[model samples]
Target: MAKPKKISTLNQSIWPYLSPRHWPTWFGVGIAWLLAHLPWKLQRFLGKQVGRLIHKVSARRRNICLTNLQLCYPTMTQNEREQLTKKHFESMGMGFFEMLISWFFPVEHTAPRVTFSGEALLKETFEQGKGCVIIGGHFSSIDLCGGQMTRFVKVHPIYKLQSNPVLNWIMERQRERTFEKTIERSNMREVVKTLKDNCAVWYAVDQDYGRKASVFAPFFGVNCATIAHIGKVSRITDAPVLLYDYYRTETGYHISLQATPDGFPYLDDVENAVAMNKMMEKLINSKKEQYFWTHRRFKTQINEGDKDPY
Candidate 1:
């Protein structure tokens, strides 16, 4: 019999994070704390400059971004694609600072900059004692915009645990505060429970999760490996699937919701996955640069021995 994977829980105590090996982590946190307090505009400026530097230095990630854009935007010229890739790095840079600002400050400070709609849409599900699943893409302003969401509606989010325990704890701690609850991406049992308890769970279906969970679907005109489990969950729980998104606006951020198009979760898994992919494509269309291009979205392929297109 195979051993079950032990889920990592949020440990609230700081004592375990105090060892000498964890000193660097603490040092980085102090620096982030200081940066979080800098004037917002200055922070954004620094983040962009740093992002430019990251684009130049992080060759592997840069290559992945370039390749993804190449695969998705066949109509775009190479030069145009390069320019957009640079801009995406810049968004990532600013997004880092925006995320810090989200983490350190109270909602009172950040709420004014964020404009959210769809509370009533979400409330419609809550009123019936049914859980909702918020389907979204990986937008660049996820952290900053996510932090502001508690002011409107609380959504339990699905996230992966980082290898670094301290970092995971710190992130989960903040998410617990911001989202009301944080469920591990692998914990489907918990996700089912959260929905049945009459709450919302935010999930992004844009990344490669291997062949078992994926059904190849059309994305930006490519047959990309798209995760199919959203349909399974919605089908089982009878939860309404709503489009969720957050993006950087000139002033601050905007978070909104939309109803998923009809026939989203057809009884056929491939049909269901295709619907999810279309929903993600719809969100990405509005905020092209702000989408998470850093992810290797095409790591999986239908071919038996195709090279992993990093």
Candidate 2:
């Protein structure tokens, strides 16, 4: 039989990726491809199992998660926090599968499985002829739901470029295929340009970026460094910034576009940061384990000499 012709993108040849050093990455990708083909329930089961393995092996990861939980859930007993830490790792493993599924799964089959609870709000905002800035947090299933969102409305996601060339190519290509466009996380200019054309841009503000372009705000129960760019962008472009919440349901994946509290884009930077934190906390409160808790969220302190949490 004749050999099938190989396919490659116009920008680059597959020969480059086939190099020996890239083989390990390709092998890992191949494993992920196989996992992507598994039944949904089975994939999740295996994902949880992988999470369990990581939880048992990575004490540093466990400690980070535990510390975050300790700061946020002060009322929970140590035993409860420990249990939540394990569950959070399992959630992280599931997040890995969710990302793969977003990239590799059949969109025709998977897109329908997503349910946008506040789709009407999404439509209503677009009708006003204003661009939308979606403010979201570091949820486990963010990419999973964000990919599905394209089926309903065009959404340009803000992403940080990955360091690994092969991995970066794979992710960028997949995101290009899934979203209207993938704007670099640092490229606020491009983000504004896309919005100026009356489009949607998704951004996250929950992580600690230290004091620069940030203010100390109460996240959960602890005051941490928080970015207030969401408000500035909204003010710059006259865009309506809405809260985006993502999670899973028994029937399918779920997402919401909640209207930001009135008087957003406040002139006071601290006010904007406080409101952003409150909104994000409300979203994460719905599902504790679904949020990315292993991050060193409290790494930055309001006072210069305060002890670090992690």
Top candidate (TM-score): 1
lDDT per residue (tens digit) for residues 1-310 in model 2: 8653433232675678789998999999999898888988887888899999999999998899999998998999999999888888888898888889887864566777777777788889888777898888997887788887777667898877665667766877888778767787778889899888888998888988777868888888688999868778888888888888888766668877889988787988889988888898888888898888988999989898888988
TM-score of 2: 0.92
**Clashes by residue pair, model 2:** none
CA RMSD, predictions in order:
2.9, 5.9
TM-score of each: 0.93, 0.92
The reply for model 1, stretches above 4 Å from the true place, is 1-9
Q: lDDT of each structure?
A: 0.83, 0.83
> Alpha carbon lDDT of residue 179, candidate 2?
76
**Candidate 2 at 1: error in angstroms?**
50
**Cα lDDT of model 1 by residue, 194-280, tens digit:** 899988888888888888878898888788888878888988898888888889888888888877877666788788778888778
Looking at model 1, the pairs that clash are none
lDDT of 2 at 264: 82
